[model samples]
Target: MEFWNDIAIEKSWKVLIGLRKEIDFILIGGWACYLLTHTIKSKDIDIIVDFEGLEKLRKKHPLKKTPFLKKYEALIEGISIEIYVPFYSVFAIPPEEIQKFSIQVEGFRIPEPEILLILKQQAELARKDSVKGQKDRVDIINLLMNSELI
Candidate 1:
């Protein structure tokens, strides 16, 4: 299980690095949970890209907006890349503050576990639906457990 998980992460890193678009964004959501908890699995990568940054990406690659999910998406190498725009409105975290807590991974920046947990809590609350909320709850629990906080 661990070996396959490592292989999946390796593939994800390659796909991320292959993107032609400039990645000036902060990593968030499920992938953030995986980054924090090495054993966690994520089927998609979520990032909070600045509006302007996403616009620039649109110029280079096809991006479709998903109103229901409140994110812009582009499929790359069979991987779903969900990009959230306007940092403040989505996560209520200023770009500068996000930068402070971000760590560079394979040329990309990822949020710290603490920030990811806060984002997951907000997501869990905002998603009134039980099904969607369950994912966030699981992510929070996984993060807490892996971090030895609970």
Candidate 2:
């Protein structure tokens, strides 16, 4: 439950920013909560990009997929980043909505609150179904209640 401090978050933002021109990406999950609320402890940063973007990165560097997570990870300067291409149905956010809420981080814009919430809600449901998504459920509930989105 250790969330990144502003400095660390900024560093991570820089990493995403550095790749902006080559990919379409968005910050999501707990780390995104840190960015929006500045009150949660997050262990990892979750980024949702397009599959084409994944291929683009693969063409340039080595990235290994993490088993079961549908994510790939690469350490940039000692920090591990988890990247994935979100399935539209699972995420429940349209591309246009994502673009509307995206905010610039180091020059690369990321999904805004609305789109992030949609994904969080979907993830929560997925977790609830598995009985292992309690954390996701709790996080989503907390966010929705606090943000009055529920």
Candidate 3:
């Protein structure tokens, strides 16, 4: 599958926007950083949802319960939609509390850049030495330099 290139990233972003029509979610990960800083487009889409919302998503997609990774997942148009739930998901800040830390922009709810930084930091630690981790470092830098949170 094409990944990280502009075409793939744009397609991923479009998938994210399309999913908003059916589910309520708190945007997170690289896409959230893109909303705040516009640094780099995310190669994949990540979002936080309540249990009810997760069920709705499952009705439409083949959602996988990946307890080991602490999130649910599905694929749409070759882009992964990684779904995080409050109790089951691991995030820098609790997923349920993410709403308190978020603001609406472009019809999507996303955590503030400060929280995004923390989340990116956690991701970097989790995937250190991988290409995704390298992108996380760049995203962290972009947020620190461009976001008002810094």
Each model's TM-score, in the order given? 0.69, 0.57, 0.94
Kindly give the stretch of ten consecutive residues in candidate 3 with the minimal lDDT sum.
Answer: 1-10
Ranking by TM-score: 3, 1, 2
- Cα lDDT tens digits for candidate 2, 1-150: 433466675676666556665676776776565555544535456676777877887887678887676568877654567776655313467554565677763343556666767777777777776532565665565566654335
Report the poorest 10 consecutive residues by lDDT, candidate 1. 1-10
**Model 2: CA > 4 A from native:** 1-24, 50-53, 59-61, 64-80, 86-90, 94-97, 105-108, 129-132, 145-150
| Cα-based lDDT for every prediction | 0.70, 0.63, 0.86
- The TM-score of candidate 2 is 0.57
Report the number of the highest-TM-score candidate. Answer: 3
Q: Write the per-residue lDDT of candidate 3 for residues 1-150, one digit (tens) a residue.
A: 222898888888789878999889999988888888877888788999999999999998999899899999999989988999987787768887777889987788999777878899999999989999988888898899988885
Comparison by TM-score, 1 against 2, better one? 1
What C-alpha lDDT, on a 0 to 100 scale, does residue 35 get in candidate 1?
Answer: 64
lDDT of 1 by residue, 45-102 (tens): 7777777788877987788888776678887666778777664435656545776888
Residue 60 error, candidate 2, Å: 5.7
